[model samples]
Target: MKKLIKKNIVIATHEYATGFPQHLRSYLSDHSSGNVLYIHHPLHPELREGIGSGYEWNSGKKRISSRSTRPVTAFGIAFFMKSLFLDIWWTLKSGKRWDAYIGVNNLNALAGVVLQKFGMVKKSIYYTVDFIPHRFSNTFLNAMYLWIDKLCVKQCDETWILSPRIREGRHRVLHIPSSYDRKQIEVPEGIWLSRIKQAPFSSVSPHTGVFVGVLLERMGLQLVLQAMPKILKKIPDFRLIVIGKGAYEHELKRLITQLGIQKSVECKGYVEKFSDVEKIVARCAVGFAPYTTEKSGLTYFADPAKTKTYLGCSVPVVMTNMFHNACDIE
Candidate 1:
């Protein structure tokens, strides 16, 4: 008889509701043969289930949970208890008997290390998309996050980092740089690649610029807005189309009006389909990744999805010097 693969794998991630986990799972499912279970808390179980796909990561709860912003609030306590219980449950359920396990992100990696305490599994891989503890918080929080990351690095058999900068201080740890997914990284199969080969987004004027990605504060929207007047002075027809949405949408819009550049700046908001992203990017001549400089270690190791998407579409980019993933282009 031909040898049969009997490994039971678990994929732990926080991106159960997003495309990151979906794409990663799709790749894993194609390559591996065994029982592969995804552990995640589905915030929108109803909608996810209605889609008739196993992509749902619901914790079997009818009501979705939220975190309170107050200092030492009851909601914070409840949230931790709930999250801890879920983690313990998954650990016990997937531990011991499984042949291999993989965890994505720092939080999930910590959970995998904890699961190893049960003395069941031998191989556990930790994959980090970016530096976590330094991403959004202040000094104290960053220190605490670094402590947790140390524990994860010490426990895992192999660690996959997304950027070279992240491998510092942990040289002995087994590290792999996660490359852009080949399947999702391919150019569109149609006239666009040919058009790009000919003139590269002929629909857009040579001066027009476009940015696609989550419109969050860390992305340095303020800098891009500040740079607008400078760019406009050089190129009169210079226009910027902002895609994606977040907390600062209205504030950014107001800043455009304050700067009196409303006509030249357009905030197109969030997009649902990959094709929509391709279409929006196809209408621009230049792409921009204007991440701000901060002490945050997270920004130093970012592999912005927008960076790869723009490159795949054959659009040239102007990115921050501090951005790690776009160094080749820089």
Candidate 2:
């Protein structure tokens, strides 16, 4: 057995959501028996500000509803600058040499690369948390990200990834395939049973599936809406209850009406608690992930928090092959 190195650690990543970081934190909180330091770049307040159940997809409830300045051109610059300042401030104040500085997101990794320059932090590990090159919001952003990605792999001492596809693509990226360990998610038995007992079943039908996650573009909510009518025809009671909100929620609602599945589907936007999702998932017979091939860059390369949450709740899932480690269904 390889002896694990016990040391002080700093985990840098994006803010909380019903996404990767939330699940990662659930696991890493007790990881390796070492003191864990969490450092995050300031995320939009609209994205945070909720607890259990309310965040289980869109619950049709508005949580925080505050908008932040989303500057496209200067996003990277601003994010890097702010995160760099926070990181340096935290590390200096701690006055301790970090045994390992792990980046849970690409930008955070880049910040670590910046920290490694002072020649004090040892073993800066970059986690290729999502598919970057293919998921950039714009062309220029994509170009800049590609360069930053190169720096992360080239400049960091170790790199960690969640998928074989990403690892294979970045063969020169000098990283270990640490596919975001999935063994740590544990909902307390009392809470789990209570949520399951409290779950509200849909009268629509049994063939319908529920999708619970942030309603983002790359996640393929559009495809789910597009496929709803077809799925309804073939599988009656095949409604989709979308839980969560994002940049594409309004357009998705429009598409829902345009597709005429308004009665069949519900857009429960932004529940303030995850316990709501717990109930929603508990009642759901099947979890849906209709991520399309071309738009599946991030979905294909990263470990989805939704999939784990679904399985954790004993709900079988239907996800695309775009996701890695997806089990073969009978």
Which of the numbered candidates is closest to the native, going by highest TM-score?
2
Q: Evaluate all candidate structures by whole-model CA lDDT and list the values in order.
A: 0.58, 0.60
**Candidate 2 lDDT over residue span 22-119, tens digit each:** 54444444344544455655454455443111111111121222223332233356655666566655655555667677776667787677667765
Task: Kindly provide the TM-score of model 1 when superposed on the true structure, using C-alpha atoms.
Answer: 0.69
TM-score of each: 0.69, 0.71
Which run of 10 residues does model 1 get worst, by summed lDDT? 181-190
TM-score of 2: 0.71
Candidate number of the best lDDT: 2
Residue 271 of model 1, lDDT score: 62
Residue 186 Cα positional deviation in candidate 2, in Å, after optimal superposition = 22
Pairs that collide in candidate 1 are: none
RMSD of 1: 8.4
